[model samples]
Target: MATTPHAFETLKLTGLGRSFGGHAALAGLDLTIRAGEFIALLGPSGCGKSTALNCLAGLLPLTHGTITMDEKRIDTLSPEQRGFGMVFQNYALFPHMSVERNIAFGLQMRKVSRSETKRRVTEAIALVKLEAHAKKLPGQLSGGQQQRVAIARAIVLEPSLVLMDEPLSNLDAKLRLDMRTEIRRLHQSLGLTTIYVTHDQEEALSMADRLVVLREGRVQQVGTPEELHTAPVNWHVADFMGYRNLLDVTVTESGAEGVLVSNEDLHIRGTAVGGVTPGGAARLAIRPEDLRIASSEDTGDGLIVAEVAVVEYHGREFSVGATAKSGTTLYVRSELAPQPGDKVRLRVDPARALVFAADLDAAGEPVAQTALAGEAAT
Candidate 1:
């Protein structure tokens, strides 16, 4: 009896990049996927998440860097030789082929025995629970069913790694949830090393064991959903990962006694950024859920007196929008319904807040705004 190798052993991408017409798409994309780890590549549109995936799949040529699977560099390998299973956003199902035929195609191409292909096809159809749809063509299947068939076809080869690019984007909300659960079930059962690319924050958070968040052809943050949710390292990440209270703040005082200033009214009593001078631009960020509307009687470690401007109610909780006395917009989330024009104090847990230096370009935005205003008045 032969033992099986790990799903993926230390897959690495070192200083990877790709460029088109002098515009770099993927740059310095260094990533390490542990054996059997499911990692989601996440970002907004044009951030190169898909480009990185294509690089891994060998569908696109790399302009720089190296890729290694188990320390055996496969940067020169073709897609078929690399043995990566890819499920594209569009499903990529062959319209004329039946589901079973699609599942068996890879095995047939690899010249597996006919009887073995039949057995594997049965198993694959059973895995996706598409036994009834086995006789149906891709054209006859629903979007969700077609996606399942695509997944089955990809995995039937028993490839070491699977790549999915926004595979659920075409499905309805209910089917998306179902597919999410199905994919998780498949991941848990098969333990296939999977690299998923998606722009949906909720999908990535719900499905991935960890995620690589990218921006501007570079990695911004990489962490599990909980880690990213609780403690993103910087302002771009904080804002991208649903941190609503990411405010531009500067240190008014420093040393053992540090006071952080935002707009004006909210004076945070803490060393906002260690090893940072008072004059430098910085950002303070927190999730909207972490902030609270303090009652008139409440006194807390992190309270910013504010007024309710808008109230949006969800069945489980409420999303509150407010303005500070300093004119900074504040967002608070709670179960209570706050009416328009209601004055409220909000508490921000300082320890839970994340701060980082402002990007030079972003830091200059206010000055540009002021200049535009001056120009408009003149």
Candidate 2:
């Protein structure tokens, strides 16, 4: 990592889009990245996160948009000319080259002086704590060590911005956690502006200053982790953020605080989002952890009485799968264990629940949503 803070201003993307034979891979991506800020592009597969990253890295040409760095246009520049360092998912290391040589390759190609190249390579190795493996080839290093070399190779250039595409996806769970800390430490120590792309919501939440959620080649929402976790802009984003129970219902009332929605036998009041209106069809989202087992003595207006269909002990608590009288499946987490076919009541804090307009299909019809109760456990 470099010792000095980055000196660049904001990097702006206006209507950034990419198309492949008329199919839009990325569309209308408008974002401003400040110097030394860590931003994460998060979504599931085929959600255009990698496409957005490639466009920023200058590896992909824009169909219609502009990329500006410090008020200067950079969209027309080549990858090397833009001078942005990138770390790929597969580690992209030279198998025959030693770790030290791999880190020095970029400097050598740039025709930097031999003394400067050696000095920077030494510093980069020390920055990633790969001194012990400097002389080893890529083939001899573990997956984590290879990833460190890849990171070192990128940071050795001391570029103003760094882009990482799922760099830790290949590592084991423990290594992934360790590298998350390492990456955050490096970003802070070097004051490097970073754009990280990951499908893992936990990884993005833990490491990014802000997160951009994408769907079908468009940006859905951009906010801090807390903002996105507590108040997603729509149902698609809420589903991605771990709200597993989605039920379709009709809105009975709407107000400043939230809205009241109900089906045949169940009624719920939750925070209204995505322009939900009274008398309109809507979807309700609830996290299993937020849905708790109601005690026998507990009486509430928002109680959801159901019959438990399955229960699994998850170390700290039990995950109960229940079906309401209306045939809607519900998943809830509780400290108490309940057997199958047992009658129970579930309660959710209205503040923690979310409600959005019903999703539509290609024909513009409201699509029926189903809740897979098993997903709450994982």
Candidate 3:
């Protein structure tokens, strides 16, 4: 299917800030969206991802800063004037209207000619593979099919950009996966620049070209999926990215070998990429998969001696919970199952761990923001 050619100007956001009741919901955000790139706004609930999306859609007004597409200012424009397509979690289809009519609603609102609207709507239904159900009402279709109608509605206008807010959240697991593929396929075929807001890490990581992680109304980190997964800026992001263990330690040494960290009963050398001065407080972040368990007889240098406290089998592997001599709990995943009440030594490769300096935010708490700033400084 052919789409109308777009002007293809980059969308630029600068110092985007939004507040309600004098409380900041999004603050000082800067981003550049390439003409055809897919970006995800990812974070936990209340992390301002939805707020950012609404600001872009002009559904909500920005408290400060500017949004631009090429040379025109867009932050001040109404939602319709922006001419960007939007899909919401609710499907938002008119129950009384047929799929084809729903898809034609936007074009009709814009005073497009009836022939042009019918032509675009037909292409859109085919684009989403909903041609067979074009005359059916939304209620008669399956959840996934209804969502396709919503997507068809959005794309029938051939808007310059597309914004989606948790569009697949209502679907079942299998359906969600199927729709993810469908969305990616549509993005590629249409060459649409898209900004997707989702709390699910897998959705963001799998679908977006780049992801922006938000926290407490601030930008925490922005990078590709592999970059964020392999090397998170700090403990917060590491935790969000599925790093199961984050241990508090003091930096004993920092050099080419790595950042050596030591606690009461643990010593680990992790990646030294983030800032960590020797003799300073730091945090060591490692995934459960990276931690291995060995018997006392097989112990090596720098092994963490701990007592197995719990064991859970997960088909292919065992998730072992162990307690160190210092009473700190650690989790490990191993193919070799271990029984509870067994003594074990934990081992982690230095290259598989990440260490970050202990930096706190204004509330006197450690956060991802400082970790990103520390990395930037390095």
TM-scores, each model vs. reference: 0.88, 0.92, 0.89
- lDDT tens string, model 1, 1-378? 011246556999999999989988889998898978889998878889999999999999999999998789998999999988999999988888899888888999999999989987898789889988889999998999999999988888888889999999999999999999999888778768889999888899999999899877899889999988766766667666897776766756565445555546676754354344577666777788878877777875457878889889877998988998878788878998989898888876666665566655554632333343353233
Using lDDT as the measure, the top candidate is: 2
Clash pairs, model 1 backbone? none
Which tens-of-lDDT digit does each residue in 337-366 have in candidate 2? 999999988888888888899876778667
TM-score, structure 3 vs. true: 0.89
Q: Name the lDDT of candidate 1.
A: 0.81
What does candidate 3's lDDT look like per residue over 1-378, in tens digits? 584466567889999999999989999999998888899998877888999999999999999989998868989899999999999999999999999889999999999998888888888999999888999999999999999998888887888999999999999999999999999999989988889999888899899999999887799899999999887886767867877787878889878888789989887778865677898777788899999986557655768889999999999999989998988889999898878888888888889888877766687555554465464333
| 77 Cα displacement, candidate 2 (Å) | 0.4
Quote the positional error of residue 51 for candidate 2 in Å. Answer: 0.5
